[model samples]
Target: MPEHLRALIVIVILATAVFSLAGKTATQLIPARDFKRRRNLWFALTLLAFLTHSFWLYAAAATFCLLLTRRQEHTPLALFFLLLFVMPPATVQIPGFGLINYLIKLDHPRLLALVILLPAFFTLRRQPGVIRFGRLWPDRLLLAYLLLVALLYLRETTLTDSLRQSLYLLIDVLLPYYVASRGLRQLQDFRDALLAFTLAAMVLALIGLFEYARHWLLYRALLGALDIEWGLMGYLGRGGSLRAVATAGQAIVLGYILAVAIGFYLFLQGVTTSRLQRWLGGLLLAAGLFVPLSRGPWIGAAIMLATFIASGRHALKRLFLLTMAGLLSLPLLMIIPGGQKLLDLLPFIGSVEKENITYRERLIDNSLIVIERNPWLGSVDYRKTPEMQSMIQGQGIVDVVNTYLGVALEVGLVGLMLFTAFFVTILQGIRQALRRLPRHQNEARNLGRALLATLCGVLVIIFTVSSISIIPVVYWSVAGIAVAYVQWVRLQTQPHATLDR
Candidate 1:
């Protein structure tokens, strides 16, 4: 057989395997009783797909499972959480194109989430009176922001590029928010989503530990073989020690996700009936936060941990126990092999801080200059701006690392205000819920407090990095969930009163 023909045959086989895996996973998502007759066939297909070692196949299978289960009460929320949590950090580029020729990645998962959300939209359309639009200031603000983005699209030099970005904003940010607010109807659904997130975080934490210790990324090489480069997969620090990216594209994002998980688990520890599960989950998430060696997220996590300690019952006792545990473990930690290395992994633990501080300062200085030129309506594509291009050529500054600055650069001061207002409304809503709930409702209050702290941490972390990834979608989804929870609380508190529409 010709070599070209053999290669084509191999590609066909791989594609078939991937589709089979997706079908099987979808079948598995159906209840056992519903799909009992097809179980053996799906099992065999899943086994075959696993043996093929195709990362894309596995990712598709996971997505299909979520899609198939969307009708279940808890599944939509679970699907949104998993889509953000389980993204593979790989990038694919068009052959013979320049550096900026990279294809859109990670957007597919968002697309999948949007697809799962379609039925929810249809259900709402069928029930006209059920789709209440009152007291949704956050949703209004989000819609305003999307409109601002559309207006900016008109000013873009490349219409196609701007359209694509607008689509991403719709699917990744707006759609997730819509799904969370509508699909997660109760506090129990939110808890189930958080549980799923925590479990996924635990697994990522273990993978990060392995990567840190061995200096080998888990799936990077496999991605590389398929011509998909993992962005910032590994970083060298502390004289060549590896900084773990985990499944997040970069260390800072991973740290941010872990910090949020830690905050949630801390709240869970206070309210959950199972003590062992809470403690174990919290410890695993804490370790996960430490492994990333990213300072911004460490600061965020510290703020969140402080909030947790300050609000919990018997705070002083818990603080004393935590302090004593650290003191008691110090000597033992020092004696163990690679213990110092582990300590070094924590932000500010060793001599690996000065470089990052200097780099961020330079980035901020450059971004401020760019923002000054386009203050009201930002440069739709900063790279295309002559001044920015000149600056890059003159000074080696290529990208804005700050999320706020990146937003200001892409949209404008107006966009920034709209974005900021969206979060402000969410925080205000949660606060209102907290105030209205009775003091005896510990679980509800705990959840509200936890979400507030999580948002606080997210706000802090975003200042240090351009969070133009699936992470922002997760953040917005949680905000939507908070808004939904607050709305539910309001309805329960005022059973007879009609909410203003």
Candidate 2:
């Protein structure tokens, strides 16, 4: 056979395998009662995918086996949480061709999976008593913001780019909110979803600890095997200690995830009646928060802790005691031989890294100039603009680290306001939920408090870093759940109000 013909045959075979796996995965999302009939076939395909070392195929199959076989209600939320934990970072190369890479970012897979499950979500929405949209300010604000995004897309560099950007907003921002509001109806549903996140956090935290101690990322070899090269794999902190990325691609992202997990665990600690469960979970997450060695998350965690304590719950005293203990031990730690080393591991402890600080300042300064140049409607895609490309060449800065500036650059002041309004409205919903709930509804109240603090921490981190990836989906999902919780509370309290159609 001709070599060219053989290469074509190989390409066809690879494409068929990829599509077949994707189709099988999508089939698992079907809300059918005869799932048992296809059990053997699904299992066989999953094993085949694994044997073939097809990362996404194996992942989809494994996720289905673990969560999909259970209650249909749990599958969607559980799958979302699992994706956050397991999905490889952005821009992983395909196995055979180094130039051709698989963009395994959390958002893309999540968008595809959720798109497949849209019918199920729609069916759930049609059910009576399901909490749909209410006259919530945040919902209105979010809608307005989405509309602005759509309008701005028309001014994008190319029609193709405009359409792509618009679709991404719909998928990552709007769709997650829709699913959370429509799919997660009951309080127990929210609990189950959070539990999945807590479990994933624990696993990632352990991985982070291992990576930190070994000074090597365990996933890098696996990633390299798949031709995935992470540019930030060699990040080092003070004392030349390796910064932990865990399953999150970068230190900043892992820090954000850890910070959010700390909030969730704190909620569990606050509300759980079981003493053992409370202490064990809280301590694990606290330790996990330190492994990333990123200052942003540490600060976020502190802020979250402060907020959680201020909620005036009985758990405040316990957390306060824990904080006091850590503070008191600082001097003692300094006295020990390796204590200074440990203290240096913490961000902003000793001499600060001048290079990182300088780069951030430069990036922020350049971002302001770009925003100034294209204040209205932004520059469609600033990255494609000559000015930004020149900055990238000159300063070696690819993206603006700050979220607010990033948004302003993308869609101008109008977009930034709409974005701010969306989050503010969500926070307002949370505050209202806390005030309206009766004393007996402690679980619901605690959940609201947790989410509020989590949002606070996330906002703090994003101020210094961009929230452009799958991380924002996590925020939106949590926001959706908060809105859903408030809506449920309002429906219960207000006798005359009916579910929105």
Which candidate tops TM-score? 2
Q: Count the backbone clashes (under 3 Å) in each candidate.
A: 0, 0
Residue-by-residue lDDT tens digits, candidate 1, 22-83: 33332332333323322232333234233335545654665565456545443455544544
TM-score of each: 0.78, 0.78
lDDT of 1: 0.63
Per-residue CA lDDT of model 2 for 1-501, tens digit only, reads: 533233233323432442333233223333233223233323343233324344555556655554444354444664456445553444432243464333223332453345334544666768787655545577677888788878777764556556656766776777777777667666766665665566556656766776678676654444444344556555556567788775577777787787888887766555455565556656666667777767778888888877877774676786779689878978888999978767765555545464555667777777778888878667766786665675563336676777888889888888898888888877787788788888887777788788888888888888767884457877887777777777877776786988766
Ten-residue region with minimum lDDT total, candidate 2: 29-38
Q: How large an RMSD does model 2 have?
A: 8.8
Please name the candidate that would achieve the greatest lDDT relative to the true structure: 2
